[model samples]
Structures are given as structure tokens and as C-alpha cells.
Target: DLFVLPSYYENFGIAVAEAMSVGTPVVISDQVHIWNEIERSRSGWICSCTVESLTETLKEALHNRAEQLDRGKNAQIHAKENYSWNAIAQQMIKAYGEIQRANSKSANP
Candidate 1:
């Protein structure tokens, strides 16, 4: 399933990640928080949430079967590496450590 989310205000865009987990390429709006990551990973196409942009991107994707398949494969790899439970837990631990250090600094000051 190719997932398309022309969102105006999406926080996590879990559906996008879920689709990617199953090797689906996406076309998502720039407003989605994970858009930058998706773009960097080459897991999907990103565009501003506009009729013209979405249409143009979809058209471009339709003409490139190899590119679409490549994106789908990349999406699955990225999802496994970045959105898996282990990955999320590790990130959470790292974030908590940063928060603790910041709090300690403020307390000491």
C-alpha cells in the first residue's frame, strides 16, 4: 500500500511509519514532523501540502517504478533502524540522559 499524507498538522504520522514498516513508499507533506527524516533517508517523497505539489509528486512517482521500489526498500530499512522498539528505547534512554545532565547543571548553578 502506498501511503499518502498531505497533512497540514501531523505530529508523529504513525501511519506513515507503519506503512513504511511494511515496505510502502510515501508521499507526505513537509508539515509532518518526520518529513525531514523520511527525505533524508530517501524513504519517501516530501512536498508542501498543496494541490499542485502533491499532484506533481504523485505524477513523478508514477513514472518511475524503479525509484518507487527503491524508496520502499529504503523505507523498510529506515523503519527498522529508527522506529523499531529497540531503537525507540535506546533513543529514549539517550534523551533521558541529556535531560538529567541539563537538570543537574541547572541545580548546581
Candidate 2:
């Protein structure tokens, strides 16, 4: 129903992505690297790495089933659109192109 990770420090947060992929709304701390994506997608709640913040967010996230379901759906869509293999590949290709362009400009100059 809900996935909560209130870690003091997190890197990539693959677990959060995995949960979003499965349409599970999350409550993650700001320390998670992917928290920005989560916040942008409106797929879950973000809280500070404190018990009070976590508890309050958990309560809010658990309070309404309808809102939870909506957020879950948003999470699923966000994961598919951003974290899917195709999406990742496209991003990589775009980054490579940018690097190539920058290199070309430096060489020509």
C-alpha cells in the first residue's frame, strides 16, 4: 500500500524507484537522491530525516485511500515514463550527444 524509507542518507534509491514502478506510493526522506524526481512527479511524500516529519507524512499518506490510489497511479506513470529502459537509453543518448557537441566546439575553437 505504502513504502516508507526515512533514511538519513541515501544514494540512488533504486528501492524507491522499484516501489514506484509497482504503483506503490512512497514516503521518502529528502536525503534520497531521487527525492526531487518523486516530488516533481507528485507520486509520493517527501519529508525531512526526522521522526516527527516521517510520522506526520506517514499519517497524511495513510489517511485517505482515494488520495493514496491517485498517487499510486501517478507513481506508476512516472516510473514508466522516466525509469523505463527506453527512457534511460534515450537520456543516455542525449547526454552523449551533448558531450560530443561540446568536444567538437572546443576542438574547433
Candidate 3:
């Protein structure tokens, strides 16, 4: 399946990752914050948010099913490596630990 999200402004793109986790390739607008990651991972295609760009991107994705399937597999792999909840939780824990240490140091000084 091809998932397309044309957001005007996105701070983060959890939905795209979520779709990719299940082996669904995505087509998103450049406005998404994760566009670079998507492009780099070959998990999806990104285009301008204009109607013409969207249409063209959609056509490309649809016409190239084999390539898209490969991308979808890659997307699932990428999602497993990067976006899993366990991984995210670990990162958040590390950040919180750093913040706590900083706060403790500040309180002592």
C-alpha cells in the first residue's frame, strides 16, 4: 500500500514511521520533518506539496510496485532499527538521565 501525507507543517512524522513499520511504503510532502530520513532510508518518496507533485509522485509509486515493495521491506527494517518503542524509550531515558544529572549539578553549584 502507498500512504501519502501532505502536511503543511509537521514537527515530527510518527505516522509515516508507523506505516513503514508494517511494510507500507509512503509518499510524503517535503514539509514533513522526516523527509530526509525517509529519502535516505529509501523507505518512501517525497515531493513538493503541490497537487502536480503529489500526483506525479503517486503515479510513480503506483507504477513501480516491485521497487515500492523493496522499499517497503527496507522501510520495515528501518522502522525496526530506529523507531521501535523500545528504542525510543531507551533514548528518552538517556535524555532524561542527562537532564537529571545536569539539574543535580546546577543545584549543588
Candidate 4:
């Protein structure tokens, strides 16, 4: 299981996505920027940041093992399709190429 807290003072939430990317299910606090994404992707559960809420959410996630497995699969798929380094590199290259071409045209005129 993976836990993510996007609060400004998170002790360690950055590893959540990495774990999820490798097929681990995630439980995220609403304070996290990726909470909505995780929920929408069905990759994990989201809850309020309080201890009570976190405990309840974690309990629910663990009790629903089948559902959690499904979510983990979804998370893995999403991570592969959206967060892969190769895809990100391609996107960055495309953006840079576009900017370079635009700059060249502006410079010519």
C-alpha cells in the first residue's frame, strides 16, 4: 500500500506515485494535488487529512481487497501510460522543437 500527503509539510509522500506506478494501491489525503487524479483513475482512495479520516479510509481500503486490487491494476496502467519517463521525454522534446521553430521564424522577421 502507498500513502500520499500533498500538504506542505508532508514528511514523505513523494514516493506514493512511484509505488503506485509499480502496481501498489494508494491512499491519498485530500490535501494532495494528485488525490483527485488517483481517485478518478480508480487507482486509490482519497480521504481527509485528519488521523481519524486516514485511519477509516485505510481500514476500508484494506477490507475491500478485491476493489483494492482493481484499483492497483488501474494505477499501474495509468502510470505506464501517463507517467513513463519516455513519454515525458517525448513531450518535452516536442515542446522544445515547437519553441525553437517559433523562435527561428520570429528572428527571421
Off by over 4 Å in 3: 96-109
lDDT of each: 0.93, 0.94, 0.92, 0.78
Q: How accurate is candidate 1 locally (lDDT)?
A: 0.93
- Residue 40's lDDT within candidate 4 is 86
> The CA-based lDDT of model 3 is what?
0.92
Which residue segments of model 2 deviate by more than 4 Å? none
Instruction: Point to the candidate with the largest TM-score.
Output: 2
What's the TM-score of each model vs. the native? Answer: 0.86, 0.93, 0.83, 0.77
Worst 10 residues of 1 by lDDT: 57-66
Which runs in model 1 stand beyond 4 Å of their true positions? 99-109
Instruction: Give the winner by TM-score: 2 or 4.
Output: 2
Model 3 Cα lDDT, one tens digit per residue, 1-109: 8888988888888899899999998899999999999999999999997999999998888998799999999899989888999878988999999999999999999
Residue by residue across 54-90, what tens digits does model 4's lDDT show?
8888889889879988989998887777678986788
Q: What's model 2's TM-score? A: 0.93
Instruction: Look at candidate 1 and tell me the lDDT of residue 1.
Output: 43
lDDT of 1 by residue, 1-109 (tens): 4699999999999999999999999999999999999999999899898999999989887789899999999999999999999999999999999999999999999
Q: In candidate 3, where is summed lDDT lowest over 10 consecutive residues?
A: 3-12
Model 3 RMSD to the real structure? 2.1
**Top-down lDDT ranking:** 2, 1, 3, 4
